[model samples]
Structure formats: C-alpha cells, structure tokens
Target: MELSPSAHVDTFCRDRLPPFDLWPQLHFDLPELRYPERLNCAAALLDDAVARWGADRPCLLTPTDSWTYGDLLRRANQVARVLTEDFAVRPGNRVLLRGPNNPWLVAAWFGVMKAGCVAVTTMPLLRAVELAQLCEISLPAVAVCDHRYLEELQVADAPDMRIVAYGGGAPDDLAARCAAKEATFQNVDTAADDVALIGFTSGTTGRPKATLHFHRDVLANADTFSRHVLKPRPDDVFTGTPPLAFTFGLGGLVVFPLHAGAASLLLEQATPDQLADHVADHGVTVLFTAPTAYRAIMAAGKADRLAKLRRCASAGEALPAQVWEDFRTATGLRIIDGIGATEMLHVFISAADDDIRPGSTGRPVPGYRARVVDEAGEPVPDGEPGLLAVTGPTGCRYLDDPRQETYVKEGWNITGDTYVRDADGYFWYVARSDDMIVSSGYNIAGPEVEKALVVHPHVEDCAVVGVPDERRGMIVKAYVVLKPGLTGGVTTVKELQDHVKRTIAPYKYPRAIEFVADLPRTSNGKLQRAELRSRAVGAAG
Candidate 1:
C-alpha cells in the first residue's frame, strides 16, 4: 500500500485505488518511461512543449480555426482559472467533459489536469442515463459540457455538480468566462503517481468500470508506444474518428501529437468520406482510425483522397489482414496495427515501418512484455491460442472495483483477447475470450444488448453475439425468442433495434436479428454463448 503522498485534496480516486499487491507489475525500463517523482502531465505536455517548440507552433486545428501552442496554453490556463474562480472547482475534484472533439474540448481537458483535478471525458453520443452512471461513479464537482449537448447532463442531474457549457454565445458561457480570465495561471504541482484521469470501459458483463490512470501513466503511453512505434514528426498533422473519450483518440489526436510538438486536427464529426476529405484538405500526415473506416473509404472510392497521409494507424478493433493489404495496395502506405485497452491507457503492442506484419499484432512495444497464458495463468507454448497477458509501464488499475482482480491476475494484465503467439513472437488475433463484442472499434458487451432486449414486451428471450462483418470486423447480432402471438419479421426487427437504441448507446443495438424458438442453453441453465458464436461464424462463412 505504498503510494506517494497524493496531491489531490478530494482523495476519492486515490482512496479507491486497488491495493498495491493486487496491481499488475509496472515497468519503466525505457529511458523515456522514467519520470520524475513530482510531475504534472498537463504542464509537461502543454507548457513544456510550448517552451521547447516555441509558442507560435500550431498545436490544435479544426476546419474553422487553428490554435498555436501559445494559443492553446493561454486558453487552457484561462480554463483552469475559470474552473477555480467561477465554478469554485477545487483541486482534486473531477471535472466531467462531455462534447465532441474540438479545440475547446481539448482546452478543457488540459485545464482540468493543470488545475490538479481528474478529467472524466465522456463520449458525446452518450444518453442521459449513461451520463448519469458516469456521474454516479466519479462524482464530479463540475461538468464543462458542450452547449449543444447540455440536455442529457441536465437530465442526469448529478448531485452537487454544477454544469457549465462551452461554445455558446451566452454571456455566462465558458468562452465568455475564459475571455475574462488571465492566461498565466500556475499549474498545480502534482505527484507523478497522483490520479490524473478515469477512463471507463465496459466489461464482458456490460458493466462499465472506471480505470484510474496517474499523471505518469498518461505520458508513459506516448513515451513507449507513440515514440518508438509511430515515430511522429514535429510537423505531422493528426486526425482520427475515435472520440477523445476513447483512449485511442485521446492518444492519437491529442497526447501523441502534443508530445511531439505536432498539430492535431480535432474533428467534431467525421464520416469515412468526410475523414478522407479532411486528410486530403488539411495536409494530414498521420491518420488514426479503425479498419472499418479504412475499408469504407476504399469502398466509397475515396481511398485515393488519402494519398497525403504518410502514416496510418489502425486500432479500436482487430485489423483484418485483407484490410491492411488492400489499403496498402491502394495508397502504397502500410497501416500500423496495434491493440490497446482503456485500462492500460494506449497501445502497448504495435509494429511500424519494416517490422509490419500484415495481420499480426506485432511484438510488444519497448518497455513492455507480453505472453500467451492458459486458464491457470501458466504460459502457453507458441502457436497455441490462449489469453494474452502483458506487463508494461502502465497496467490495469480499476477504481474501487472488484473486477480489478478479474483483469489483473498473477501480476499480469490479462487482456480478455485470445491470441496465438507465433515462433517469431508476433501475436495473431483470435476471437475475444470474453463476452465483449468489438464492432468497428467499439467494445460492446453482448449481455448489455441482451439486457436491453429482454425488457421489451415483444421479446421473451435474446442472446447477442458478435458476427463477422467485412467492414466493421464484427457486428452485434441478436437471436431472439419472441412472444407466442407475435411474428418476428422486418417490422419486429426494426422495433427491437429501435428499442435497444433508446435503452443504451445506439452502437450497441443489434445490427442483425433472427427469430428463434429458443436459445441454446446448458443443462444448468447457463447461456451457451460459444455455440451461438460458432454457428454465427459458420453461417457467415
């Protein structure tokens, strides 16, 4: 239970950290991974970057405006002031950010860190109930949300949480408040081990768990994965489709570029065509997104538009070898594929340049170690499918959740993904070992969709499984047992899909629905998920 004397006054996150013995073994073997005892990532990424790269270097970009390192620094400093002076937000308080990716949202994230508060950034697509669950978990003192997306947060009504909107023309808006503040506020001198942010990930059971990351953990991902693998240049322009709430987008679009003194084009919304247009028009050198998007752009004949990209990264879900080969054949640039989890922060395993293996999730990045293990946690031989265990500078640290034991076992972060390690040390992707369905880079739980479906009056029973899709990698497909009187047809399928969307995030809704008399079940009454998944794959094949 030895932790640094924490800088957080609230102590909520610090108090909730899993005991040290339960934590996975953390490594800082790389020169870059070694950090000082007292470090604030906001200052290290923003202020220090501004100092090293000069103030006028462009840092954040959108279709509408560009923010220089100086511009972002001044605005971030102002945001820190507004939080303290205007909203009475104290150091160590959690500041929930709800918005699409934009310059203002970026500013708010840095500002919260600089103020020594934990930043809990949520996906803008989340509904009121979803937002309320996050609010209950983190207990943020203030929520700096996008003005256009204020209704859900308001409906959430988190107790004692003040809501402030950004990007509004109102006199009391966040923009106006920032305009009144000075741009030279001091950053809080927090310990390297101080809790910086809490990213939420849905477990196999569909329950969202909060993963706590320290200030040092924030930079460790960039230092190891981004530095050694992506090798971003100072002039690179970053753009991606994953929301900042997803650790993937945060690293690709914000943290990695900032660490390299490059510019990130923050798009509030991007379709495959729109992303291609932006990459071409904005002179984007580096692109981060899912394999589904890459295939969509190619299918839509927009692949040629991405000729400007020098480096492309694919994650969020497994990148199919065919997608990798096709994109390369289209653009003459190989896509770097990797696997990262919210609990671990960013990419720990990836390959770049000549080391690229078409479909394999390349060897672990510098400062990390990975292996395949059996159900008993013993290492499995190469070429055998088993649970992927990894140890790195950052590992799973769930906040006050018993599932910490489930994720971290025998001192290794056991990523629920099943993988086969070749004799060459390359990890080949197998199906997910857990009940989580990753579709188009989104991790959705089958049980969550099942939960939403059973509540509908029309559905007597339902089982959701991840079925293969060429574009999305995997799509949620639900097999249903409808009430005796109702005929499940196109109309009923539409009804169930709409019902699930209303109940949870729209992405988790089942894309395909088939009416069945009953679902396969064990004699003991357990759902036979593996059987359904196998049948779905066979049928798809």
Candidate 2:
C-alpha cells in the first residue's frame, strides 16, 4: 500500500538523515551527540519536562487518578528518599517492580532511577516459576508490588528480598515512615554509561536474556525515535496495551510521553473495547498497540471512536497487510509499523507518514544503521534475505551472558530476524531466523501462514510453527482461534487449510490444524510460537 504525503510527518523525515560515511571502517561525528559525564533518567527526561512545561500540566493519567507534572516529580522524589534512607537502595542495586500498568508503577520506576538503582520490571502475569527464575538471575534487593499481585511474589525460595506493597491499605507504619521523610531528594551521581534498567527479552525460542540499558541509552531512544518517528505533541495524550515491563511499551507509553511533556492515559485493564473508550473519553491523540489489537478494534467496528487519534503505532510483531488496509479504510489513518527489540532499546527502523510501504518495516531511523548480512557477516544484495544487523546510539548490553557474543558481534547488534532490504532502502521482514521452517528443502516462514489465515473471514488469531515429522522432517502446523460465531470442526479446518494454499505457496499450507479458544501470548502481546510448538510436540509424543 502507498502512503500519501503529510506535512507534519514529512517534515520530521526530511530533517533526519543517515551518516555521510558508509564504509566499513569509517565513523562520523554526530552533532546531536550530547552525553554528560553523569546521567539520571529522572532528572534528564522527567524533571526537564516538568521544569519546561510547568507544574499544572498532567503527566500521568489512570482510570482512577491523575498526577500533574509537579505531583509526579514530588511523589517520585518521595519514593526515592524512602528507597535510599529506609530500604538502603543504592547504585548498582537491582530492584524488582511487578504490577499492572498504573500511576504508582510510573512513580516507582522513576523513583528507582532517582535512587540510582537498576529497575528490573517483570510482567504482572508471571507465575512463581518465572518470577523465581528472574529473581535468581537479577538478584533484586527490593521488590515493590501492587497488592493485587502480591501472591505471585511470595516465592518460597526468594532470598533476602524486601517487599513493599502498594494499592492496599497503605500500612500506617509504612505510611508514617514515608510521611515523615522530606520529598526533596537529590539525583544519584551516576555516569552516562551506568546501567539503569535490565529489560528481559521475551524468549519465544530460548531462555529469556536480560538486555541492559544505560542512562544515556534510555534518553537517546526518546531523542531519535520519539523525535523523528512519533513526534508526539505536548498537548497530546498517549495510551497503549503493552505492559510497561516490556521495553516497547515502556518507551511508547511511559518514557516517550514523559520526555515530550505529554500525558499518558494508563489503564489497569487494556482490552480493545476499553482502550477505545479511553481514547474517546480522554481525547487521546497518540495510540500505541499491537497489530492484533488493531484488528480486533476493526473487527468490533469501533474504529470511529478513535477519531480523536492523530497517530497510531504498531509493534511487538509484524503488522499484517490486511489489518493495515482495514484500519486505513475504517479510520483513514496509516498505522506506523516498526520492528523493535528489548536489545535495541526502542525502534531502530520505522516509516514516517510519507515513506510507508505496506508489507515492509520501513527504513532505518536517524542515528541508526541497518544492514542485511549473510552467515559470515557480509552484506547481502538488496533483494536477498539475510540476518538484520543494526548499530546505533543504543545497542544490546546483556547481563553476564555468553550469548552476548552471539548477538552483539563487533559493534553491530545482530537481531535474529531475517529481512530483505529493497533498492529504495525499505526493509521487508521475513521471519525470525531460527523460526524459518525448513521442510523438504523448502523455507517457510510461520508469519506468512498466519497472515494468510488472518485474511480469511473465519480466523480470529493463529500461531504457525514447525512440528517434527518423520516423512517430511518438519511439517507446518497451525494452531488457530476462530471468529466468535464460527464453530471449529473438521470441515472448517479443511477449508482453512485450503484457504492457506490459495493465499500463498501450496507447500507452505498447514498440514495439520488445531482450533483453540485463544493463542498463548506474552504479557507484551507477542505470539508465543515456542509454546505452541511445545504443545504440538507433546501431543505427538
């Protein structure tokens, strides 16, 4: 699909450009580089916004409460003092924050930064086993959890971790201690290179790896992507469905809005219908969510309620062409789809309004360079598919993991995604390199099959994966969720399989189908193909 030109988005693209020197050994000094010896995200981003925008402006909004810029700053400082004087949280200390998306989570996140501690945010839905694994790896000193999810943090084996509960009856003892303390707190003296947060990747293919980001790296994303790609206005309100624990959601819903002096509409429950209601009620201008949510909103015929939105961004997975087309037809808005990872901090490649190419993930954003490389790290031809290698202001810094060598080679961060760059520099996403199914000497991407099924009227959600087969070595298997009125049966499965054959290459059609009520998704709304593959293997066994 082609995108028409827009003055606002087009101006942003024109002002940002790639580095002049493109050789393998050449490096160019960038004028936008502003790195201080000491850095604190709370001071550099949030405090600066409050000072420039004034105290009256709303900084964060939840269903039940709203905090002004000054209010948020004061509360963050209060939490910072409590963490430092009472809990002994200091530099290099890791603190775990597990809760639903709310104003308290934002306050605690900034407070952790102000106290010069590393904030390791985990999903609220994580079970004891997952929580234990994260605790073992991160070795957090303190845990601040919402009262609703306190049971999940009650692991029998978590060693010497302090638990602070919020949203319950704020214990008088704890409240008294906090109330007595002064709200004025100084920013911790931290270097720009000091690690601020440890974001764990959603391990759909392997064990989850922790990706560390420095203080400057955090703000760099706001400068590059938020300034160049999102361009959120100060009066705009932002809302999204991604959990704040995920870096994609953290940047889009929290950091970007704070950096831009805009307010974020936070929701404890982020269903599609609820999100639409919030957008209409709050006059939210910018919306960040996944492709599935967009499809659901269109399916529900509620796109008209989003008339207040000025920009819509999709991430966490590839955006299907059909979803994009449907949204444009319904709302006359082009959904900006970008590919990002926890390792990259934020989106490195994206399309602005003028340069959008449907079925493509757009060109590299400013301050970042992307290349498709062969197995030996050599650049491939423009049209040939290869592993996507990216280098920019923010890159992966894993936590004591040997896999760092595999992901970050030399200076470039090697994303496991396979992509093809066209002659015009538009990057087309293929699939995860490891997820490419090789069957009878043919390469098949699971997303291709899933996209085909989504275009069909009966399919709601689906996950495609490769299952072990003696005859073909690996066979395509699709785990599908049908629409609300559609019934899953043998005849429907055969018809869907035939639909896939007609949509794409015949060999890529699903050999087997399992209709289910829902697909297993991560807290960030990414499809967990690994879980589906495991289920298939277990069934075969």
User: Which numbered prediction scores highest in TM-score against the true structure?
Assistant: 2
Best by lDDT: 1
Instruction: Evaluate residue 193 in candidate 1 and report its C-alpha lDDT on the 0 to 100 scale.
Output: 96
Clashes of each: 0, 0
The lDDT of each candidate is: 0.88, 0.83
> What is the TM-score of each predicted model, taking all chains together?
0.83, 0.93
Q: Tens digits of per-residue lDDT for model 2 on 1-541?
A: 1112211211211122122121112122245547766778889777888789998899899877889988888878888888888888767688899998998888889998888788899999899888888888788888988888989798725878888887777663233445677878888777776678889889644567877777877888888888888898888899999899999889998999988889999887777877888899888999999998999888787899999999999998999888888899999999999999898889989996878988899998887899999988999999999999998887766676667768766567889999999999999999988779888889999999999998888988988999999988899999989989889889998899999999999999999999999998876678888788889999988
Which ten residues in a row are the worst by lDDT in model 1?
A: 519-528
- Kindly provide the TM-score of model 1 when superposed on the true structure, using C-alpha atoms: 0.83
**How much does each candidate deviate from the true structure in C-alpha RMSD?**
10.0, 7.8
lDDT tens per residue, model 1, 110-185: 9999999999999886889889888898999999999999998899958789999988898998999999999998
Show where candidate 1 strays beyond 4 Å: 202-206, 435-541
**lDDT of model 1 at position 522:** 24
